[model samples]
Target: MNGDWFIRGRDGRLSVYLPTDDAVLCRAERALGGSWEPPRRLGGEQRLRPGPAVGQGADRYTHLAAWRPTKPGEAGLVHSTHFRPHLAALDWTPIGHPGKTGDRTGPPAVAVDARGRAHVFVRNQAGGVSMRMQKEKGGWDPWRDLKGGDVQGELAAVTGQSGLVELYAATPAGILHWRQEKPAAVPTLEEAMDASVRPDTLYALPTSATDTTLFHTDDSGDLCAWRPGTKPTTVLPSAGPSRVSAVRCELDGHDCTLLAQRSASGRVAFAAYPTEQESAGAWWTESGPQLPADALVSLTVDEEDRVMAATLSPSTGRLLISRRKDEPGLALEAWREV
Candidate 1:
């Protein structure tokens, strides 16, 4: 899980969802510098893993997907839920499982395409990928298998300019495989990339309507990015062993990408690509407060271009959410326990 569970409503308010002991916690930031409301439980008993995927559809409703164990020490399924942000309080609709019963991999990857349909991807126990889509009239379609090689890690998905969804997953041997799906079509695994170095975590960011950039950390602890026509470029050397999250966003009216990682040293660090000219050099790195030794970091950008990061502290068994300050520079403020 490496992305935010937050989505911005059409009215500009940001809502973030986190999973607590046996419930999903919901909190919202009021528009126009208003503070965040007190946390409210969304009402579910299954324990949720960090890295839940969330997207705002054209209908102005927020959709979310998360994985929870069916039983202690058993395989899990990916579940879908949604809410209308305009309502003061939310009752999450149980949208049912988007994956099969044996699906037991990482958190679901979700994205709302141009037509406002919600698409979700998860790994099945068979080491293949499964996909499900929201119908025009509202319910999800049956899970469709997107066959691939033995995928050992989570899948990264992003909607492309043409309304096609692209998926990326790394094989156990460190090779990356990608595929694209159009509306009402099955996806086929295309050619694979030769990434000899395996990454502990991987993230993908769509840089434009037609292009996307893949970011991952090599075994040498370097943060690297792979573009369409270029070789893998080391964005930051010595990033340390950690999961990396990235989002394509704007900074001062310019297109940029934000990268966040919790290094082996227990420090949460962030770097940004402000512009094309600054993409090759050392990013503006800002180190945040120390995290728990076993903290898992997930990063996301809200509708207001504010970067939100959630770290699950295993020591306290608490999930902490923090927002980057609105200043011009890439400075992150302190974390607030949710």
Candidate 2:
């Protein structure tokens, strides 16, 4: 769940969202755990895109957003929330395009803050970014322009270590970032952080209460980690992959970050390292069967703290879950089709 395709609630059950061509489908762990119920379709009319970006708030609510066709050749964003886990999701709310008329925008990235507000960011047609967010009174505020130029692809948003919302967008120039000085405040664009990154490959993870680490593929196609104001450090050398999904979890009692990527040939690969310790080195291991190149993959931690990986089977188109083996390093159980 690059935008957190899956989220764990206070009850410790996992809920996952999938954006098929026309609608968003959902599945959740049974209340007692051990299995997932059948897929539940969250209705939408327009043809949808890849992500139904999801973020969980302090209230334990999971907010979901996605981009869809507003009209022929026009795209718009829609959202919903899982206020009560395992229950039906709320109705879809239309978040119109940034332009007065229809306009093109990239897939959404959502971040729910400590105060329970969800901030949504998208790359505007003008190569900058625009945002629309939920209001305090339970409705949405009008789309706001957080200016930028040279922004290339999808945006990234994360609630920073201080409970403030921060955003990142890859650009030919560098990675453009925006930060809220205070909670619920408008995000201001900061100095561009330098990185020779590919568009749509940027991902952010809060490494500490005050530090955030960025993961992206460099010009050479190597995955690199960069803390703002520092040089980018290679995490995994180039393997001809374009994107990756990551999650933070405890590994062998050590705080670790796990990464999963679908290779160019459609096989899933995994790697891990101590959180924020890129200098400690890391290695990539390709495992499991090959999936469709278009198939998206995600990494998440189960309630037991074991890393779990998920993807869709190309041939059967069924959802596949691979749980981490208990004995050691990132080995996975047989791919289970649920």
lDDT against the true structure, each candidate? 0.63, 0.78
Tens digit of per-residue lDDT, candidate 1, span 97-119: 43444434655677666667777
lDDT of 2: 0.78
User: How many clashes show up in model 2?
Assistant: 2
lDDT tens digits, residue span 246-320, model 2: 888887788998888887667788888999999898887888787766677787777787788888633345677
- Model 1 global lDDT (CA atoms, 0 to 1): 0.63
Once fitted onto the true fold, the runs of candidate 2 whose alpha carbons sit more than 4 angstroms away are 43-51, 68-75, 313-316
